[model samples]
Target: MTLEENAREHPYEPVPGDVVRDAATRRVGRVMDRMGLRVQLRPLNGGREWDAMPQDLSPASQSDAMSAAVAEANAQSWRGR
Candidate 1:
């Protein structure tokens, strides 16, 4: 998908603990900057930084479906209380 489409689809505003992937290398990282979507990831070890902006990030359909299932399970657990 296009960058705009990806940006609009992501759930959060891109903050710390949010998962993002670098478009350049397709490596996943955790967002460290909310405003800029700057992500910190370490492929080797040192924790390099990568930006997700201007880059497309289409969440894998399988992962999205899995997330929805997990969310539903959590909701069901909460309702069982």
Candidate 2:
């Protein structure tokens, strides 16, 4: 079978809390929920959520996740000042 056929048969499905990158937006977010074929994602630092097709998402790299966490931490630290 062709790659397209195989992909259709077995699409990538990310569960809630999984970090992923949206190919369409080139943004990293955590899976918030799924609605039919579309998946909801929220920024790591916490912001408005957006919906993206499963086909447009892939697992985020470890560095991406860490970078977001560090950025959030830095923001929080500044807020405490």
Candidate 3:
């Protein structure tokens, strides 16, 4: 099978630093690590990490990523007050 075919057979897996969404929780986070079939995700604003099943993860949309970043900035500003 061609590389493209192989890739199609295997779903895309996120690497560390990749922003993704957890469909199960409808939350956006960065991929920290992967253990077996579970993927570790940490919030864009920084917080506790959680393990999510690979099947439940999808690449975050541009809008979603921007929203997360804005939320983090807002949180930082609030804390500085």
Candidate 4:
């Protein structure tokens, strides 16, 4: 099989635009892109990006997504003050 085919057989890595959570911290961020071998994510509001392994991430639940978004908004407002 071709290398592409082999990679296709493996489990999907979160693609850019997917909302994911860090398994360790439960931090919610949107998938950015793969960096070297790590999956990159950015905060809901706008902050430094973080890298995580696909195994260390899972799709964020609706409640978790909402909470994260709210937290980000609060942070932005606080920063503006």
Using TM-score, give the best candidate's number. Answer: 4
Model 3 lDDT tens row, 5-79: 986799778999999989999889999999998999999989889999987888899999889879878988999
Write candidate 1's Cα lDDT for 19-81 as tens digits. Answer: 544567655554455344444433222244655563454333446445544665676678779
Lowest summed-lDDT stretch of 10 residues in model 1?
A: 37-46
Q: How would you order the candidates by TM-score, starting with the best?
A: 4, 3, 2, 1
Select the stronger candidate by lDDT from 2 and 3.
Answer: 3
TM-score of each: 0.37, 0.71, 0.75, 0.79
Error of 3 at 7 (Å): 9.5
Once fitted onto the true fold, the runs of candidate 2 whose alpha carbons sit more than 4 angstroms away are 1-9, 70-81
- Considering only N, C-alpha and C atoms within 3 Å, which residue pairs clash in candidate 3? none
On lDDT, the stronger of 2 and 4 is 2
Model 4: residues with Cα > 4 Å off, grouped in runs: 1-12
Better structure of 1 and 4 per lDDT: 4
Instruction: Give lDDT tens digits, candidate 4, residues 1-81.
Output: 897687668755789999988986679999998988899999987799988888788788899999999999998999899
Higher-lDDT candidate among 3 and 4? 3
Candidate with maximal lDDT: 3
Ranking by lDDT: 3, 2, 4, 1
lDDT of each: 0.50, 0.89, 0.90, 0.87
* lDDT computed for candidate 2: 0.89
Which prediction has more favorable lDDT, 1 or 2?
A: 2
Candidate 4 accuracy as lDDT? 0.87
Worst 10 residues of 2 by lDDT: 67-76
